[model samples]
Structures are given as structure tokens and as C-alpha cells.
Target chain A: MWQKLYTWLDERLGLGDMYANLLDRPEPKGNWWNTLGSASLFLFILQGATGIFLTVYYTPSPDHAYDSITYIMNDVAFGWLIRGIHHWGASLMVLVVFIHMVRVFVTASYKYPRELTWLIGVGLLLLTLGMGFTGYLLPWHQMAYWATTVGTQIAGSVPFLGEFILKALRGGPDLSALTLQRFFSAHIWMLPALLAGLIGVHLYLIIRHGESHFPDEED
Target chain B: MSGSHLSRRDFMKAATGAVGGVITAALGIPVIGFLIAPALREDKAGAPIAVGKLEDIPVGKFHPFSFTITKVNGWERTASNYGGFILRNSEAPDDILILSSRCTHLSCTVNWNESANAFLCPCHDAKFGPEGQVLDGPPPEPLGHFEYSVDDQGVLTIVPVELKSEA
Candidate 1:
């Protein structure tokens, strides 16, 4: 039964073989640029862990939110550090993810068998950027407030669906306390969960598909 | 440069080249630093802050007394806008209320109306009962409160709270 469970899990993840193959194969031996990808993963992990700690004390209500943040930053043990990790880690992830995408593009690794992997990678990249943007406003400070208010207003500027997307984001015609609550919930849960699943699929695709040949492959 | 003559050793060197030398020092260090800066920064949270004199606050009137706070939020240093309000009680000599200027409705500025005996929101005509309860207008709920203290010097001090806005 245990063997069966292992097999079932192995069949789903297949990550061990994927790692073996990637290492045995030379293309993924990787270079300094590849560290950015590794760094990105590290940042993601940092975000998730610190985010959990933050949730322990975070009050999502509009009334208590700013104070909750103040509590986290000032009152809690290393609260500011936790928030900083979550904050800076997010920006770092965004930067590295973009650099990874650019590397893939310049190398033309997006072609052929890697197309699916690249597509998922691009999707994940966009998701990372969205995550950064959404999380920025969570602090609910003067900058976060006005910036997000302007951002939502920009979204509402789109023809037809503008108001819809804006309303969906803000949870109202005018930005309200509800808007803050909704964004907070989605930032901590919805977007992260989606990114996690997508990242898993992305990793699986990379493992199965293997690394694309670099431009120097023939040389 | 021949297509067929590359050795595994040469390939390995080429592969790791991007992760080595100048690039490692120039990019890797900063990348790590940037990612970790937030966690590395310290905060002055829980540190008691001193505000203004309790005697200076005139009876039956509100005065805005602000305290300078040293705050470390993630990688940035934020110094201003920490103390927005330190409302002195109408009748009590030392009673003070620290109300967030933000309206409960949309986090806009709310001022104390001595005549109306309420907090008035200029953004949407919202009114709050003297104690920060919602009285009339668009504010979804009562206005918020800031943790406050009257110090030994009789200074009214308020801890700065984050302003809430449309998510």
C-alpha cells in the first residue's frame, strides 16, 4: 500500500527523475543568469512564509488594517522584518522573473518542444507581476492608498468592461472599506494559490520537456 | 569553433560561466541583498513616543498635536505623517482622544465639529457620533480609533496608523 502511494505520488510529481535528467544534461547546468531563477524561487518561498506569519496578526478590516500593519511593523517581534521580507521579496521575485523571461527570449528557448513550458512560464511571469502590484497596496498607507485608487481608476477607464473589472477589484463603484478587505483576501489567498498551482505545472512541464538547447548547443 | 569537437569539461565551464566571476560579484550579491533587505531592516515598533503638553490643549476645543516617529517599513525609512490627531476632551482636563483623520467611509479627512458635537467628513457629508460612531452619511461604519496615551509631561501622543483605501 505504501509502495502504491509512493508510485502514485511519484507518477504525479515525477520531479526526482526530472531533476536527475536536468542535471545529467548539460544545458541546464546553467550559468550566473540562472541564479536569478533560483533567487526568484527563494523570494517566493520567503513571501509565503513571511506572509503566513503576517496573517497571524493581520486584521483585514479597513478600520483596523492600518493599525494592524502598524502593529505588525512596530509591535510584533520583527514585524517590520517580516513585512519587509514579504515586501522586498515580492519586488525581487518580479525583477528576477522578468530577467529569466528575457534570457529565455534572447536564447530563443521559447521555440519547439519548450513552447508549452514557455507559455506557462510567461503566464507565471505575468502572475508574479500582478502579485507584486496587488501586494503593494496591502500596506494601506498614503502611497498605497492613492496609488491603488489611481490604478483602479485607470482600470475603470477601459471601455465597457473597465467599470466591471474596476468594480470587481474594488468591490464597489467607489473604493470602500470593502474594497480593502477584498483585495487583502485575494492577495493573501486567491492570487498566491493560483500562482502556486501554475508554478507546479510550470515546473512539471520543464522537467518533462527538459531544458531547451542553448544558442551555443552546436558549438 | 568546430561544431563537433566540444568536450564535456569545456561544456561544463561554459555552462557555469554565467554564474561566475564579475557577474557573481556584480549581480549575485546585489540580487541577494535586494531580496533580503526587507527582513534585514529593523523597526522601532512598541517604542513609546512623546507628544505635546496636556495643559496646552484648551478646554472644549480640539488641537492637532503630532509626534515625530522613526519607522522602518520594509526597506524604507518613513518619518512624517505618523501623528495626525490627538484630540483633547471637551470638558475633562486631561482626557484625550486620538482619532485618525481618515473618514470611516473612504479614509478621507474627518474633522471634529464642536458645534455639531460630531466628526464631520468633508468627502461625503458623513457624520460620526462624538465618540467615533457613525451618525449620518455614506461611511459604511464608525470612524476608526488610534491608540493614544497621555505622557508624564501631559503630552497627548498618538501612534500613527496606516490609512485604508479602496483595495
Candidate 2:
């Protein structure tokens, strides 16, 4: 009976073809370095899951942001673990993505038909940093506040368009409640959407090109 | 003759692309404005704030005074605390200097260390002299100052805008 059910679904879904195409096919003999890409993807998903859990208790406002996080840490069940994963996961994802990029570069995997993959990977790295930048202000603590002030000021130092860029970033001339609100919006919605979409394209390109062989000294 | 090669399928594709572009612009333009409206709006300056009575302040000492500025940012109103050290140069009403407590480095609050005779920032160990001059550390400029006025009733009112001191 189970065999009949499996066969019926497989016929309609082309499960056999999918298994052969997606999971079975492969190229280069990968070592530990190859695992970093998957590890980065895993961390991204982990961050998304834990971030969703956090939003249930996290209030994005100057008045309540700090208190809400306090409640999450102190009052809610397993909230510490969830937030802890998210907090540490962000750093881990950045590190993993960076190392993965380095490995690809060193192995010369970005050459030939895989150049587009490198371009998309660069976008992913930037988006990851954007996520970190926007996420840093969500806690609304002193360190976050002052750090962001300096960070935005650094952005404001662009030769000509500096003032406009600074205003666009902070939503005003100063770091007020608007800054916090906008940063929270970008952190949870805008940057993540771009990251996820680019990650999808990155993965598709990876599968299309197949993993490059570990480069040898030969021409 | 030019129109003869245009097929109905081609027309359909063009029509679909036009519709999609129109739909995108209809939603996109307003969304962009909504996100960026605050940046385009003029920043409102704070009102002149009264810190304290001028008679009570001592000469040759840094008088720490704090005031709250209620600013409406987006949908919320936030009351932010701002403070500065008022140095009365002498008993003369016009002989006064006010330095913002915010360190020039990263806006961290600075303290008037009487023993050191300078303002010390706890965040980066930046130091400023009595006249708000940058003495040591990473602050690119001196501590800012506020514009002020002494009323007939001897009330000290400050404009609250931080004027950057030239390095």
C-alpha cells in the first residue's frame, strides 16, 4: 500500500527526475572548505527562524525596544536561547559567508562560466553587512545608539552626496525615533528580502555551473 | 509594410509588458516617497530652553545643567535629554561660556572632572579643556557650545543648538 502511494505521487510530481537532477548529480571532490557555503545558508535560515520568534516579543520603538528585549530575555520561555542563536547567528553568518567567498576566490572557482556567481556572491556579502548595520540599532541600547551615530556620520562623509545619504539613512538630520523605526524596517523586511532573493539566484547559479574542481597547479 | 511583420502574439506580449510596468510604477512611486518622506522634510529646530537662574550659578566652576527636548519623530514623540556645562567667566552676565556635554567623538556624555580640570569622555577617554578645546584623544574637534541669553529676571535661556567649535 505504501509503495502504491509513493509511486502515484512520484508519477505526478516527477520525484524520480528531481532526485536524479538535484541530489544525485555532482562534480568536484569537496573537502571541509566546501561546507562553508552550506553552513552560511544554514545560518541564514537559522537567523530567519530565530528572528521570527523574536518579533513576537520585540517592540521596535525608542520607548519599548529595550524593555521588550529585557522581557524576552527574562520573562519568555526559551527566549534567551532563541535570541542568543539570532545574536550569535548573525556574526556566524557574516564570518561563514566571508570565508566561503575567500575559499571560492583562492580556489579560482569564480573564473570562467562562474563569474556571475561571484557577482551575486558579492551582493550577498554586502546585504549581509547591511543586515548587520540595520540590526545593530534594534536593541536601542547606549552602545547601539552611539555606534550608529558614528556609523551614519561616517556615511555622511561622502564627498558631495554625503548629507543626502545621511538624511536618507537616519530619516532626518539627527538620530531620532525615526532612525530607529526605519532601521528596524530595513533590518526585518527590506535587506532580508534582497538577501533571500539573491541567495536563491546564487544557489541556482551554483547548481547550474556545478562546483568547480579543486584547482590544481596544471594549466 | 513595417506593420505587416507585427504578429498578434507580439502585440499581446507588448500589451502585457506595458500593463506590468504600469502596475509597478503605480505602486512603486508612492512606496518610494513613503519611505523617504522624512529625509526630505526640513528638520525642526528645538525651542529656546531655560536652564536655571543666573544668580545661583557660581563663577570659575562648571555648572552642569540638563534639559529635555521633546521632538516628534515620525509617529512618536520622544523627549531626549541634553546637557552642558556652563562656565561663568566672572560675575558679569555676558562673561559666560557654555559647552555641550556630548563628546565630539561619538556623542557620548562627558563629565567635568574637577581634579583633572577638564571634561573627560568615558567612552573613548577623550579630554577637553575648560574652554571646550580638544586636549587629548580621538575627537576631531572641540566640544560644541550653545547660544544663550540672560533675561532681565536673571534666567539663563539657551538656544539649544550645538555650534561646532573650529579645530
Candidate 3:
């Protein structure tokens, strides 16, 4: 019965062909280092899932934001676990992606035909940092507020355009309700959308070129 | 056309269509509901919040007032607190003016300078007079005001309206 179902679907959807062409690609001898890219991908998906669960409870305003987070931590069922995972997951994702990039760099995987993949990896790294920065401000606590103040001020210090950049980031001079709203939107929607798109391209590039092997002494 | 004449392929196709339709409806309805639920929600900003007694605000002085107003954003209902100042003219005690502490220039909370007799924005040195007029500095216009009313009990009630930067 299972074989019949599989054959029927495979005949219509070309699943057999797809599996053979895509999943059966050759790779260099697999090692622990080879798992970083997949680990980064897994962590990203975990972040997205936990983040969605969080958005159900997290209110993104200056007033209730911190209180809502506190409620999620204390009141909701398994909320502490979820929030803890998300909070730590963000840091872990960043660390993993950075290490993956470092591995790629040391292996000289960015050379030859895989330069675009390296560039996309860089974009992904930046997006991950952007996600971290924006997500940090969603809680609207004293630490988040002051950290954002200092962070945005650094952006504001950029020569002639510093003030404009600062105002753009904060949605005003000092962090206020608008700043919270802006950061929330960017964190939840804009950055995620960009990250998703870039991740798609990054994955496509990886599949297109196949995973680069560990550098051999001959080359 | 016989009652038991259904072939294996025909039976599978019928089952697939029924399952597909059911799955599609099951998934699509919730997605559509999630997309439209926010629009359908009644976004109530809550009733007018009582700040304080009218007489408590001394004449010729700007008193800071803060109140939490329940703001409904989509499905999430959260209480957002806001800050403003109640200014009474030195000579005209009856004429009470309420101004939002948020500066028009950049939305920073402006502080009332007793020495300068002006509302000073620490971010950019923008100043506004006791009457909420722009005194000097970067602010293009005066501070915005919140609509308020004094009840029979002498308590001041302010309707937390949208913060308009335009005067």
C-alpha cells in the first residue's frame, strides 16, 4: 500500500526525480564542521517558531511591553521555557552563523565560484545582527532603552548624516513611543522579511553550487 | 454508470479531491481569519483618564501629569502611559492649558525650565513658553495640547488624543 501510494505520487509530482537530482548530490567526506550551515538553518527556523509564539503574548509598546514580557515569563504555560529558548536562541543563532562564516573564510570557501554565496552569507550575518538589535528593544525595559539610546547615538555620530541616521533609527531624537513602534515593526516584519528572502537566496546558492569541500593540501 | 463500477484510479482521485478540499479549507479559513481579525477588532483607546484636581495645578506653573490609557492594538490590549503638562497662566487662573510634554521637534519629553520660564527639550534645546508657544531654538511650532474638562468635583479629566505635532 505504501509503495503504491509513493509510486502514484511520484509519477504525478516527479518526486522520485526531484529526490534523486536534489538530495543525492555528491559531497566531500562529511565531518562535524560540515554541520554548521545546517545548524544555522535549524536555529533560524527555531527562532522564527519561538518568535511567533512570543508575539502572541508580547505587547510592543513602552508601557505594557516589559509587563507583557514578565507576564509571559511567569503566567503563560511553558512560557518561561519558550521565552528562554528564544532569548538564548537568538544569541546562539548569531554565534553559530558567525562561526559558520569564520569556518567558510578559513577554508577559503569564498573563492572561485562560491563568492556570491559568501556575499549572501555576509548579508545573512548582517540581517541576524539587525534582528538582534531590533529584538533587544521590543521589551522596552530600562536596559533595552539605554542600550538603544547608546546604539542609535553611535549611528547618529556618522559625520554629516549622523543626526539624520539617528532620527531615522529612533523615529525621533530620543526614544519614545514611535521608536518602540518602529523597532517593533522592523523586528517583526521588515527585517524578518528581508532575512527570509536573503536566506532563500543563500540556500539556493548553496544548492546551486553544492557545499564546498574542506581545502586539501594539493590546492 | 454501475453502482460498483468505480475504478481504483477514480476512487483515489475522488479521495484526493475530498481530502485536498478539506485540508485547504481547514488551513485557509484560519489564515484568512488571522489576516482580517485585526481589522475587525474594536480598537478602543479607553475613556478619558482623570489626571488630578484642577486647583492642585498652581497658577503660573507647569505641572507634569501622567496617566495610563488602555490602547487596543489588533488582538493585543495594552495599557500605554503618557505624559503631559498642565499649565495655568500667571494672571489668568481660570484659563488652564494642557500641553503634551513630547517636543514637536523630535518627540523627546520636554522639561519645564523654571528659570527660563519655558519648556526645554534636552535633546535639542527647543523651548516653549508657558502658553505652549515656541519661545526659541529648533522647534518650528509650539507644543501640542490635550483636550481636557473639569468636572463638578473639581477633578481634571483629560482625553488622551493623538499627539499632533502641528501646533
Q: Pick the candidate with the highest TM-score.
A: 3
Two-chain DockQ for each candidate model: 0.03, 0.01, 0.02
Backbone clash count for every predicted candidate, in the order shown? 7, 0, 0
Give the alpha carbon lDDT tens digit for every residue of B110-147 in model 3: 88888988889999888889878998888877878888
Q: Is candidate 1 or candidate 2 better by TM-score?
A: 2
After superposition, candidate 2 runs with Cα above 4 Å error:
B1-167
Report the lDDT of model 3 for residue A15: 98
Let me know the TM-score candidate 2 reaches against the reference structure.
0.56
lDDT of 2 by residue, A33-137 (tens): 988988898788878877876786788889889987877676555656778878988998999999999999999899999999999999999999999989999
Looking at chain B only, the TM-scores across the models are 0.54, 0.91, 0.63
Error of 1 at B11 (Å): 19
What lDDT, from 0 to 1, does candidate 2 have?
0.85
Classify candidate 2 by CAPRI docking class.
incorrect
Sort by TM-score, top down from the best: 3, 2, 1
Worst 10 residues of 3 chain B by lDDT: B30-39
lDDT tens per residue, model 1, B1-167: 67789898778778777555664465335444434545554443445555666777666555655555545453335665533455665646446666666676776778878799887888889998766788899888776666767655666655544422222
Off by over 4 Å in 1: A1-29, A217-219, B1-167
